[model samples]
Target chain A: MTPVGAVATIGRLCRITRVTWLSELLEPGRMVSTAIQVGSQVFLTACLWTALYAHTEVSAGLQEHQAVGYAVLAVLASRLRPLSRDMAPDSFYRHMREGTILYWFLRPLPPHRYHLVRALGDQAHGLLWVLAGYGLCTTAGVVPLPDGRWTLPAFLVSMFLGQVIVYQLSLILDLLCFWTVANSNALHVSHFVQSLLSGAFAPLWFFPGWFTTANSFLPFQSTLHIPLSIYVGRIPVNRVPREVAVQAVWCLLLWLITRTLWKRAESRVAVQGG
Target chain B: MAGGTALRRSVYRLRLSWKLTSLNVRARLEYRVEFALGILAGILWQASVMVFATVLISRFPGLGGWSSGGVLLIASIRLLSHAVYGVLFANVNRLHAIVQEGKLEAFLLRPLPVYRQVVLHQFHINTFGDLAVAVTLFSLALRRLALEWTPFKIVFLCAAVVGGALIEAAVQTALSCAALRSPTATADWTGWLDHTLSTFGNYPLAILPGAVSGLLTFVLPVAFIAYLPAAVLTGTYEGTLVPREIALASPCAGVVLFLAARRLWNWNMRRYEGIGG
Candidate 1:
């Protein structure tokens, strides 16, 4: 493509992102809500970890600071694709229900690219919240800085890969709506599962050996746990490469699967009112 | 005659609620597989609490001097009451959408109380899963406790569960008043409160620092939902900020709070211009 064409495409994608952001912009209250929720969550999470560590110096190979740091960071990282962002029934299923999904096929941009660009926008918006919270918490001394010189760089790389895996997994969930029209329950269940398995609710560390071992086989932990563990230095700087590699492999597999599903989903689409 | 009229009124409400609930459940049943998965989701929803409670007990042994069994009892009480709240009153959480869609205007014209009509708008299909897990945990908690099973204790336990549900209802009801004015903003606050409750509500607040604990007690009153009652049962209510007498009357707090909140809701409704205007 010509430079002019490429620039125009980039500009259009930026505008396409409004599907992910226009509502929040239209209602500034949502922004205030995000601030309050993020702040309180970090505080509450930090307190819980510190309280738990009060009795014992180390449980599951993590000290007060390490565990506290991990828990606090998990709360902030969760801001990346906060659960509440999707609570409003808008997106694929709503579009399908309202019989407007065909617009995806008719648009100049491919449906899959449109879907992904929206997620990209959502994550970008979420990243702003994450950065602000991270800065505030680190300054406030609620959360500590990375101890190792390479820890911050390694964590950022791993976190980027992990988020790619998250976007693909979300795409798969979105595609399932083509098959199951009333899949709200499935959506809720999937969110809870992701939160539980990804170590957002609690570090996979505190869980029993069997639970963590089982979680290793799933892609969910690649989304939040690995990056967070790397951040807190629990997974060790040496193992960061291997962990990021594993996350990369999951991303590749999910990408292929979601790509194929998007093709099949087009044919399976059904409108709500015949 | 007044007493008879009151009894008749109660019966009428109950009968209408049952009819509406059946119709709602039937609608849910149209998607059989999704309905089944929804129940699983409900159980999973509550299971997150259980998982945290289990991890805490197994790893740490005791929190705030409360034993595993005592903590489990507190959790079970909160979960069961939560099931009751989920079934009967959680619909208020969706009030923002209702008001935005102009459904509230239609509800205001109905003969029944608007709150009741709004609540019974649809059955909470997930409560089936919630109740199953809650009952199972309560039973397990019972087995763990070595306390004497006196009739008074059993009755108080039941009352505490009801009180816990009422307190939850009261909180959601108060939040719904804001939904009338700013549907979008209130939605976020409502979601935040639910998260805070689910995340922090199950534990013994005594374990937290004095300031945070006091916030939960005085500002939020989440402790009265189950922690204090469970603490009182386990004999750990002594260190709490409230007097022993007030702690013992935790159930009464739910009653009084619910009544006051209901009155507030009525006043808020009268002032409600709604989003449509």
Candidate 2:
């Protein structure tokens, strides 16, 4: 494909994806349900953090406000990242049974790129939720601003890289469907491991030293933990560049891995009986 | 004659369900590696929250003046409830797909009752993993809390486990029944409700703001499933927003909710015409 043609395809895909997401958001019942769901989660996390801070002698090296900020921001940020449902065993089984996946091969553009665009669109609603949560938390005085000057800019950049890394990781899992006929259990197991290792459930700092030390060797910590830690000023401003660099490195590594896997996965698509 | 026939039918269905469940487990075991991975994954998944609870309790003594053991008891009970719910009620999750694809015809064509067919469609083999962990943790918490054990407390403990499971199954059944009326409405909301109950149910209900605590207790009744029951056993019943007598009546509440859910399910089910049927 020519450069201009590729650009046009991307633009069209983005528009289609965005329109679908917009319609989904506009659905009144779904909108209300999401608000209630997200509101409860934020409120629950705030309650949990408040209790933790209240009884502890040491505030886990964070001020009460900083800890609250991290708790709420982490929950809000979790919304923006979604892994592919293709790896889920049930979906793969249906696609295979119905031969729906053949449609992907017939598409003009690669299916992976199409999926990436859709993933971005999926996050559109989550982005709105995050904005609303930030407003609510701020107005309610439930969370405080970060201590450092560079926190906001650094957090934004790092978070983008974090999402990319998460997307690449999920794509790699999805590509595993080429090997295994049933991967539903694998998806469930992987999701649980990734969410915990990513520190979405709790800050990695609270974990024992050996766990955090082992986590440093892996890429999961760089996804949600590093970005949120930066946002909450847990990582010093001087160390901001280092943390962001770590995320970028993980993103690039996962990107390369996903690309290689996609090639292999395409070749291995065993077409069964007519 | 009518009551005897009903009893006989129930016995037959229970025996058939046991056989079918065994066969399902055997089929899953054929893929040994995958089966093992699923169980391991489930254990790890359930363990995550326990680990989180550990970290929190380590930092703070306890929420609502309950000890670490008290908190762990609550967590363990919740897991046990979830395990039972998975075994007995998780088929409701599949109701969305069954209705969406008009697969209800399969159940309708079966010789068995539609509810029985749907409920026993697939036994959740993964929940055994959760059950094992919950039992182990509950034992540990029991040892740690060191409550004076009477025959009554032991019996209440048994009742709480069964009651907690009933409450969860009731909620899930009601949601599934509601899904029959509006396909898109209940599935997402059911998931949200489950997540809210399990996650928020971990902490002491006393820590939640008054309105939220009341909502959990009186409206959703998630409090009865784990928190209030645990509070009663731990002698910390005073901390709960609701009365101690209400906490003690959790078993009765569970029975009442279960019957209500059944009535709702039967009423809605009678009116259900398959989406694309």
Candidate 3:
């Protein structure tokens, strides 16, 4: 596609993204439910971390504020993924089952680009939640601000790269539906693995040395841990570039693989609903 | 004579359900890979919980003053009962999808009870995996705890597991009442309830603020599932928001609360307007 055509496609996708917002705004009940869930989640997390720190001043090289901030940030960062999209009609498995997938192949837009567009839209919505939660936490003094001048900017850049890696990972996950059935349980198991390994559940610093070492070799830690650690000053500003570079490498590698899978998936497909 | 006939009829129904469940498992077995992965998923979920808890225990001196063994006991009991709930009543989570797919209409036409059909809808191959990890952890907890075990305590332990499962079933069943009409919204609440249970159910509620602890205990009855009962077993009632006598009777309270929730479900179920499209 030409650069101008690419811009036009992105613009149309952005409009569709607006419709997603409209759809969510249309459901006040779900919105309220989400607010309550996120509120209670942050509250409970802060309480747990506070309780855990009551005895020791520091454990695993993290102070009370840093640990609490990291845990609370993890809670907010977790909201970065749209919760119900997997069950929505746009999902690959759902589309395949409902026979609407043929439209993707028929449309002028390519399926791979469509997938990325929808994922970007979802991340936009999820980022709104994260922003709201972060604002609440910061204002309430539940999470502390980082000390360095460059911390916020560096964290933002690193977080962007991390989310790219995360999206690439999930793109591969959705593409798995081309060969397999629903497998919701397997999906859930993978989610658990990501949460545990990605430091969404707890900071990797709390984990033993060997576990963190093993995690460093995988793409998971860069997703949540590295960025949050930077925000909380666990990973010093001097080391920020190194961590972000690792994340960018993971992103490039995953992007290449998913692109290959998309090619294979399109070529392998035949009429199914007939 | 009437009671005997009723008993015989119930027995027959139970036997038929067993046959149906086995057939369901057989059908799932047709997808060999999904079946194996389903079981693996269950084991990994349970194992992940243990891993998180064990790592915390190793790092922290004690969680909110409860011994590591005490916390483990609560976690094991909660997971064991959760496995039981998965076996018997986890279909509540899927009720929305079932309604959306028009399965409920078919269920209503069947001779068997709609609830039973829904409960038996899936094989729940993962429950076997959850049960295995739960039992192993419970055994390890029992060995590590400093408390002495009596015959009464042992019996109460068994009752506690069943009661805990009942409480969770009741909560989800009551939530499912709304699923008949507005399934999309109901799914969020059930999902949140599951999230709450998985995150908070393992730890002692005392770690939380007093009001939050009360919310889990009285408003939601999550504490009744395992923490209160486990507290009674070990006599570690220090931070429990409720009285000693109340905690001791948690299992019994679970029974009462579940019965009340059932009554609520039936009342709401009557108003169910299916959205079978």
lDDT of 2 by residue, A1-274 (tens): 9999989977898785675466655556656777788888888988887877775555668777777777788788777865233212124445544566666678887878776776777676578778888888989988776566788898889888888887787667667767765566787787777888888788777888889999998898887888888887788879988888888888888888988988887887764322
What are the RMSDs of all candidates, in order?
2.0, 2.6, 1.9
Q: Which tens-of-lDDT digit does each residue in B57-129 have in candidate 3?
A: 7788768888778888999999999999999988878888888777888887889777788898986898998
Off by over 4 Å in 2: A1-7, A19-23, A83-94, A271-274, B1-8, B26-34
In model 1 chain A, where is the ten-residue run with the lowest total lDDT? Answer: A82-91
- lDDT scores for all predictions? 0.84, 0.78, 0.84
Question: DockQ scores for all the models shown?
Answer: 0.62, 0.55, 0.58
TM-score of A-chain in each prediction?
A: 0.95, 0.88, 0.94
Question: What are the TM-scores, per candidate, against the unseen true structure?
Answer: 0.95, 0.93, 0.96
Q: What is the lDDT for B245 in model 3?
A: 86
Residue B225 displacement in candidate 2 (angstroms): 0.7
- Model 2 has how many clashing residue pairs? 1
- Give one digit per residue, the lDDT tens place, for model 3 in A138-222: 9999899778899999999999998998888777877776767455666767777888898877788888888989989999988
Compose the digit string of candidate 2's lDDT tens values, residues B162-255: 8988898888888888677665555567778778878877778888888988888888988989898898888897668878888888877788
